[model samples]
Target chain A: MTQTDLAAFLAHSVELESEARERYLELADAMRAHHNTEVADFFMRMAHESGLHLEEVAQIAAENALPDLKPWEFDWPGEESPETASYEAIHYRLSLRQAIQLALENELAAQAFYASFAQSSADATTAELAAQFAHEESQHAAQLSVMLKELPPDDAHHREDDDDPHMPE
Target chain B: MNDVITFKAKDYKSGVKPIWCPGCGHFSVFNAVTKAMAGLGMNKDDTVLVSGIGCSSRLPAYVDSYGFHGVHGRGLAIAQGLKVARPELTVIAMGGDGDGFSIGGNHFMHACRRNVDITYVVMDNEVYGMTKGQASPTTPMDWDHSKLTPHGPGVRPFKPAALALAAGAPWIARAYSGNPNQMAHLLAQAIEFPGFSFLHVLSQCITFCPQQTDWKAIVNERQDAALEDEDEAARLFLHEDGFQTGLLYQRQRPTWPPEAAPPNDPDLTGGFRL
Candidate 1:
C-alpha cells in the first residue's frame, strides 16, 4: 500500500506481474482444454508478454531489498491486482476480440496504477521507476489496441450453444 | 524438505486445466486455495484436498497435493476419516451447494458438531450446476429461473454460517470468489484454525445462473460481521443478509479427536471392545 518506499513499490510491481502471468496462463489452459485453440493461443501470447515483463520486475527486485508481502497485503485500487483481468469478463468460449480487449483493459489498468504511483510517490527513486513502468504499460496497451483493430469481424463471437448441453429433464 | 523448492501459487496446481466455464467463480476459488497453500508454505505431500461430486467437487484434481474425489456429497466424511486416521496430514473438504448443503446436509451438520480438526469449504452457487441448473438447498425461496422450479422452490435457503454456528463449529467464515485476496486470507485462517472450521464461499455458476455475475457488486466486507460471542453472532446472522462477507463467527471449542490422535492400534479388533 505504501508505494513511496522503493521496497514496497518493487514488491507490488513484482506481484502485479506475477499474478497477471498466472491468470493469463490459467485462461490459456482453460481455453485449450475446451478446444478453443485460437483464443487459447492468443491468451498464451499474452502470458508470454506478461512473463517477459515479470522478468524485468524480478530483475529490478533482485537489485533492491524488496519487502516480503502476502498476496492479500497489497493495497490495489480494486479487489485484485490491476493486471489480473477480471474473471467476469472472460469465458471458455471467448472470441479472439474479447481476449484482446481483456488484455488491453488489463494493460490500461496497470498503466493507470503505475501512473498514480509516479505522480504521488514521495520518494524520487520510486517515482522515476513508476514512470518508466507506466510508459511500458502504455506501450503494451497500444499494441493490444492495434491487435483489436486488426481482428476480423467474424472472429469476435462466442459459440452459439455456449451454455450447458446436458440439463436433466 | 531441504531439497524442495519453495512453491508459488501456480506451482501448487496439478497442471490439469479446470473444465469449468470461463466466468465460473470456482476458478478464482481454486486460485485462492493454491495461494493459501503457497502463503503457508504447505508441504504438498502432507496436504490433502477432498471433494464430493459437483462442478466445484472437481477441485481436488486441480491441486498438486493428495486428493480424494469421493462420492456425491461425501467429501467431509472422507476427509474427516482421513484426518482422524492419519493425524499428521492437513485435510480440506470442498464441494458445491447442492453437494454439501443438500445431499450431504446430514453429514454437514454432524461434521460440524463432531468438531474434527479439519476445514470444510462449500462453494455455494445456490444451484445444481452439474445437473444443468436445479434449485439447491441454498437457493432463495423465489428463484424461478429453472423450469423445474417454475413457481420457485418456495423454501427458505439454508444459512450455512448460521447452521455451522448452531451445529457447534468453532470457526465459521463467508467469502466471495470475486474477492480472491480476502478469500485466500480467510482460507489460510480457516486451515490454521484448531477445531472444525467452516468456510462458505459464494461461487457463481455462470453457465446456469448468469444473474450471479452481479454478486461482485452486491457482496461487501463488513468489519462487524465476525464475532467471538455465539449469542451475538446468532443475532448478527439473523439481521444481516448474506451479502456481508468475512469471518462471520468464531469460538474456541474442544476438538473431538483432539489435535493429535493416539498411536494406531496394531490389531484390527483392537477397538472392538468399544
Candidate 2:
C-alpha cells in the first residue's frame, strides 16, 4: 500500500477497535450504574477483551505510517461503528441474551466491513490484513453466539426500587 | 514549514471513562474537544481546562491535561485568573447551562466583555441532569415532565448565542452533539480565535430528554456559506432554523491580558516601625 493508503487504513482500523472498546466499557458502566451486578461484570470482562484487541490494533498501526485523523476526519461509516452501542440504548434490566445479541450484531457488521475491505483492496498486504481482521471478527461473533445460548432466561423485570428518584413520580 | 507534531484523540482523553448516562450528549462534546485539541496540535502541558460544577464540569477530569474542576459557577472566573497568571497557556472553561447562565450569569457577562483569550464551552442540556431533573435556564418553556414544574417553567428559554453576540463576544457559535465532525471543527476554530470564544453546544440529557434524539435531523449547516458579519449572522439566526450549525459570528478584538505595572512599595509600618 502507498503511504497515504497505509495511513488511512491504520487510522480506520484503530478507530474501529477503539470505538468497540469504548462501547463495551460504556455498557459495563451503564449496567453497573443500574445496579445489575452480573451483567455489569460480564460487560466489564468483554470490555477488557476489546481493550486487548484495541492494543493489538494500535500495535499494527504503529508498524505503518498512520496519519492522525482528527475526530471529524475519521472515515467511519457512522459517527461510531456498529459494535459500539449507544450509551442511552442500554437499560439496567437488560438481559445477558440481549447484550449478546447487541455484541453479535456489532461483530457481524465488523466482519462485513473487513470482508469488503479485503475483497476490494488491490494491495496484497492490505488485503491479507483485512482478511485476518475478518476472521477475528467472525470468531467474536461465534463467541457471542455461544454466550447468548448459555444465558438463562430473564425473569426479574420489576426488581428496581419503585422510589428511584429518576423514576417520574 | 510547520513543525510536525504527533498526537491522537485518544491521547487527549484521560484513562478514566465517563460515568455519565449512556446517551449523554456530553460524551460527543468530549470527543469533539479532544479531536479539536489534537487537530490543533496543542501541547497537553501548555493547555489548562477549568470547569464549573455539574455533569459537564466533570469534563476536565476525563481529559488528559492540566485541569481544575472548580467550585460551582466559578469556572470562568478561575480560567480567567489562570490565563492572566500564565498568559502563555491556552485556557478553556466548560460548564452546563445552569452553571454558566444561572449561578454564573454575572461572571459570564463580565467574561464576554473582558474579551480574554480563552474558549468557553457551555453544554446546554436544557434540564439539570446531575441534580436529577430540574428545569434549567435553557430548558424549553413547554417541557413539563419534571414534577417540580409540572406546568413547565412557562418562561422564555435563555438564548445563549444571541446573548453572547449582543454582549460583544468576538467569536460565537453553536454545535450539536450528534454531529461530532462539525463540533470538532467549530471547537478548533473557537480555540484559534484571539479573544473570548463562546461556543453554545446543544447537549441533550438523554435520560431526561430522550425525545431530543431527533436533534440529529434538526441540525443543519449554516446558510449563505459564510460567517460574514454580525447582522447577517443574526438575521440568519432569527429567520432561519436556529438548529443550523456553524461559526455564526466572529470579530477581531483585543485580548484582555493584564497590563504590566510597577510593583507595590514595602509597608511603612514594617520598615519604619509603628
Candidate 3:
C-alpha cells in the first residue's frame, strides 16, 4: 500500500505506539486473569512506559492531519502490534525474567522492522522518519535488557503448572 | 490529512475482549482474520461473520463487523441463507471441529455441495476445547486424553480437507495459527473465492489441549508452495501423509444465490409494527 501523506504517517506512528500501549495493558489484564500477580504487575509497568512513549509520538503530530487507517488498513506485516504477538506466545507461569525476555524479543523485532524501513526507503524524508523510529525502538530494547539483567537468578527446575482447566484432561 | 478517517485492525476489535485462555491459538486465528479483512479494505458495515457454538465460534464477538452467534452446529446454514439473501454483502462462517462436524455434520457436507459464495473458517483444535474438554470428531483414534473417552474414540478421525474436497467444495486449504501471515493470505483468498471455501486452521487450545502448543514445530516441518494445477494439487493433497499446510485446491464454480423474486405479501410494507 502507498504511504499516506506526511501528517497521516506521523499520526499512524502515534497510533502504532498507542497500539503497543494498549497491547501491553491487555497483556496485563490477561496475566491478572491467570492470577499471575507478579507478571501482571510487570506488564502494567510496561503499559505505563508505552503510554509515555505514545505521548511523545503524539507530540510529533503538532496539528498535522493524521490519516485515519481502519484496523485492517495499517501496512504492518504482522497481524497485530509487535508486543501483542510476543505476549500471545507467553504462558501464564512465566517468571519476570522470562517476561522481560519476551518483551526484549518484541523490542528487537520492532527495531528491525523500523530499521528495514529506514534503510530501504528511497525518499529522504521517509527514511529520516523511519531512522528516528528505529532509534526509539533501539532505546526500548536496551532498556528491556537492563531490566532483565537486574532480575534474580531462576532455578532450572522451576516449571509452569501443567494442568490448565482449558486443557483436556 | 484530507483523506477519510481510516480504522486500523485494533479499531475493528470489540470492547468485549476475548475470554479465550491466554496463549490459545485462536487469538492468532482472530488476528489473521482481522488482518486479512484490513488488507482487503472492506467496509465493516459491508461484512458479516456468523459462527456456531464452541470456543472458536466466539470469533464473531471479537470483530466489529456484523455478526451472528448462532446455535450449535447451525452456522453454515445461517450464513448460507444470509448470503443468498444479500449477495452484495461479504459473508463468512466460523466454528470448531466438533460444532461443524459432530452436531452440524450434515450441514457441513451439503454446504460444500451447495457451493455458496462464502468462507468457512474452522479452528480445528482436534479435541473440543469448550464445555471443559471432550473427544471431537477430528480427535485421533487411540489417542485418548479425555476422562470421558478413557481409551480414545477408536473410530477413525474425520479429515476436514479431504472431506471438503470429496464433498465437492470449490476451495479447500489448511493453515496453522503459528503461521499467521500465510493463514491471513489464505483467508483473503478464500474470502475472494466464488464458491464455498473451507479454511481449516490448526489452532491450539492451550487450556484444554496442551499438546497442540507444539503444533508450530510440527507445522514448520510441513510447507508446500501454492499449486496452480488441479491435477498436481490433487496428487499432493490425496497422497500426503496428513499434516501438510498450504492451499490444497481451488477451482472456479458457479455461486448459488437466493432467487430474485420480489416479496408478495401485504405485510412486506416498509413500516414496522409498533
The numbered model that scores best in lDDT is 1
User: On residues B26-133, what C-alpha lDDT tens digit does candidate 1 reach at each position?
Assistant: 999999999899888899999999999999999999999999999998999999999999978999999999999889999999999999999999999999988778
Candidate 2 regions with alpha-carbon error over 4 angstroms:
A1-4, A91-95, A149-161, A166-169, B1-7, B14-17, B221-226, B258-274
**Candidate achieving higher TM-score, 2 or 3:** 2
How are the candidates ranked when ordered by DockQ, highest leading?
1, 2, 3
List model 3 lDDT by residue over A1-169, tens digit each.
2453456557557766776776677777777887888888988988898788778768877666676554445676565555444423666677788888887887777777667667776667767887898898889899989988888886684445666453334
Candidate 3 residue runs with Cα over 4 Å from true position:
A1-19, A51-84, A115-131, A154-169, B1-5, B220-232, B241-243, B257-274
Structure candidate 1, residue pairs in collision? none
lDDT (Cα, tens digit) per residue for candidate 2, span A1-169: 2232555776788888887776677668767876777778878877887788789888988888877576666665555654576544555566677777877888888888777778877778878888898999999899889887787776676434465545443
Displacement of residue B51 (Cα, Å) in model 2 is 1.5
Candidate 2 accuracy as lDDT? 0.80
lDDT value, residue A107 of candidate 1? 96
Error of 1 at A58 (Å): 1.4
Would you list the clashing residue pairs of candidate 2? Answer: A87-B22, A87-B23, A88-B22, A88-B23
Interface RMSD of structure candidate 3 (Å): 4.0
Model 2, range B1-274, lDDT digits (tens) per residue? Answer: 0146667677788878787876688988888888888888888888999999999999999899999999889999999999988888999999999999999988899899899999999998898889888999988898887898887889988788777766778888888887666889899989988889999898878777777777877887776444658887667656655687788888787778757565476564565655
Which 10-residue window of candidate 3 chain B scores lowest in summed lDDT?
B1-10
Q: Pick by TM-score: which candidate is best?
A: 1
